[model samples]
Target chain A: MEPIIKVENFTFYYPDSQVPALAGINLTVQAGEFLGLTGPTGAGKTTLALALNGIIPNFQGGRMGGRVMVAGLDTAKTPCARLAGVIGSVFQDPEAQLVAEVVEDELAFGLENLAVPREEMRQRIGAALEMVGIASLRHRSLRELSGGQKQKVAIAAAVALRPRVLVLDEPTSELDPRGTLEIVALLQRLNRDYGITILLIEQKISVLAPRVPRLVCLNKGRIVADASPRQILAQEKLTTELGLEVPPVTALFRMLRRAGVYHGDLPLEVDEGQRELGRLLGSRASRA
Target chain B: MPGKSFLHKLNPLTKVVWSLAVITLAFVYQEPLPILSLWASVLAVALIGKVLREILPAIRGLIIFAAIFFLFQVFLIDEGQVVFTLVPGTGIGRITDVGLKACTMLALRMLAMTSTIPVLLATTPPKDMIVAFVEKLKVPYVYALMLVTSLRFIPTLQEELSLVIQAQRAWAYDLEGRNIIKRFLALIPLALPLLLMSVQRARTMAISMETRAFGAGPRTSLHTSTFQLLDIGVISSCLLLTAVLAVVSLR
Candidate 1:
């Protein structure tokens, strides 16, 4: 697969701070890939995410080393406004990000700033609302929306710009379980159906483990682990050392494996664990 | 506040012009009868816009202020026949017929001048107002956006203030059972957190706006405002009323 994003030995230090926010980072995201990024608080997850779209070096007055390239544009050198066409970013707080009073107007705001034609802006707004399944909310006030719905509008606003990659920085952290699920499902659909590359940042891995095929763990401003979700979750010791919350299902399967009662790969999800347990019981029944 | 009446459909600039005209006419006319008619005309516009019910509270507030103003002005002016006196031997609280008439005219003039605001606000959305300022008046979009965005966050900040108050209360901080001076001092704790949070929110909002390519180049709007026949009619009528009032007052 072609790499859409490439980070090479990138190091960043925030203004007025001696400590580096990110250090010695190297990562590559392939086209149409859904990658999960998880780390504990103060682990530079947000800094790396911001670096993807030139905000770290451009908008933020930070000293940095190395380069980040998204769709062949060097993020550090490219203007943030120009890079906005290639990378769409969604932040954690939906309330803070919204700029318009109404839903459709919110989507139109970015396009309007980009100098998109009125006709094209309208079409993109409609298509994005349809994709997010919030067509009925097109006329609703931003103040009237729930947190989940507001986040969805934020996503739709970003998606309307038709960027090649969408980077969400803990978009579900402020939402309820149902809202989290809705966002996760919407992201998967965007990645699978529209071929939009997604880099989802989270504080926990449980939600990401089942949905994302690849997982990257960050620690102390460095890339600590980069592998498949199964491979990453199976290492209970490493995950515990990293201070990541292991999903309950993955934890149970690991304990079973330790006791020599179960074998094979650990399940990352509940249904996968159920199937694994059923196969183990079947083998024992046959022996009996 | 968002409704589809004649005033609502008119261009925002037209309403702004009408508001200015009403304010000008109130200032121009000195007689009680003309000023009272001007106030009545503003109320008539509110009735036509179907916002009279919505603006009743604002009207009530204006009435209370006007009444207070009347009380103060009526006692200060001592002209014409003395109508009533309180504590008679000292002329400390004496009211005369001319003073009564003058105070009434002044109060009515104030009511006429200020009441146009609520009618204008009730008919036009803030977005439309900003757009009119940007497109027609040649105001820069960034400044207009700043004005509207600050207005938008007022309610959000108010909500945050209540949350901070509640959080402080949870810590057994008594805000209500205090003297007036203490109550004023109690707001410091609540205000500090809200101020810090607002600064943080402002930073986030700026980043969000920049990421969306705000100030990238020339921008366009989704909804464009064009002056319709109703807007022209409203504008002409406002001009005519202003001219007639000027002429009548000078005569």
Candidate 2:
């Protein structure tokens, strides 16, 4: 797969900060890949997400080094307006990001900024809202929306331009478990069905682990681990020391393996764990 | 508060002009009768718009303020004939008839002026108000967005403010201090966190807008406010009313 986003030896420092927020970071995301980004607080995850959308060095004035390219355009060279059509960014708080009073207008916000023709904008707004399952909320006021619906509207706003990549920074952090699951499932469908690349920044490993194939962990302004979600979660010592919350299932299997009860491979889901345990119990019963 | 009514359907710009005209005409007369009649007219408009119930709470507060203003005028100007004397000997305690009349007119004028704003705002959505400013008045989009976003966050900020107040109270802070200065000092804790939170929210909101390509170039809107026949009728009536008030005041 060709890399749509490439960051080479990137380093960035905010004004008045002693140390760089993103230090010597090198990463790449292939076209149409759903990648999960996880880390402890202040681990440069948000900084990296900002860099992808050209928000870091473009809107945020800071000392910077090295390069980030999205869809063949250098982020440093491209204005955020130009990059916006290629990379849609949904921030953490849906409330702060909403610029319109109604859902339909909110979805049309990016298209309007890009000056999409009215005919095309109407189609895109309708299609985007439908894509996010918020078509029914078209005329509803933002004040009347639930938090989950608002976040969905926010996502719809970003995707209205049909961007190739969507970068969501902690999109589910403020949501309840059901809301979080709804958003995560929607993201999964967007990636799998629509072929849109996703970079999801999340604190909950369990929520992110099942949906995304690849997981990249950042720590102290550096990429510490880059592998499949199962591989990253299997590094029990590293993840624990990095202050990441280990998925409960992954942790339980690891503890069972250490106690010498049953071991084959780590399970990331309940059904997989149940199968593994059933097999172990059967084999031990036959031996006894 | 959100409803479909004659006033609500009027173009936001027309409503704005209507309110301005009513307020300006309220100041045209120094007589109590004209001011009170204008106030009645404003109340009637509010009733027609079906926002009278919603606007009454704010109007009730202004009535108390106007009463205080009337009383202050009754004692301050002692030049006219005495209406009454509280302490027969003390000249300061005397009520003058001229003071009572002038103050009554002033109080009514103030009430009329204050009433028009609630009538305008209670019927118009803040979003539509900003949209009209941008579309009709040709205000810059950035300023209009600022106005709309600030208005949208008002309720959220209020909620956050009360949360901070509750947090301070939880810390055993003396929020109910009897001394005015001490009570004022108690607000520092509430104000500082709210300021910090607002600043942080503003920063995030800026980034969110930038990422969406806001301010990149001239923008188009999904919502376009257009002046209709009703708007023209409403605006023309306001112009006629203002002209008649000007002529009547001059005569």
Top DockQ prediction, candidate number: 1
- In terms of lDDT, the poorest run of 10 residues in model 1 chain B is B1-10
DockQ measured for candidate 1? 0.78
Task: Write model 2 residue lDDT over B1-251, tens digit each, in one string.
Answer: 45568888887889888888978887777688888988999999999999899999999999999999988778888778999987897786788889889889889999998898888888887777777888889998878877778888899899899899888888988889899999898888889999999999999888887888887788777667889899999899899979988798969
The weakest ten consecutive residues by lDDT in model 1 chain A span: A202-211
lDDT score, candidate 1, position A287: 98
TM-score of 2: 0.96
lDDT over C-alpha atoms for residue B201 of model 2: 90
Please give the distance, in angstroms, between residue B140's alpha carbon in candidate 1 and its true position after superposition. 0.5
Per residue, candidate 1 scores C-alpha lDDT tens digits across A1-288 of 558999999999999889899999999998999999998888899999889978888898878999899999998888888988899999999899998899998999999999899898899999999988899999999999999999999999989989999999999999988899899999999999999999999875778888898999988898889999889888877798788888898899999989999889889889998999999999999999
Cα-based lDDT at residue A222, candidate 2: 90
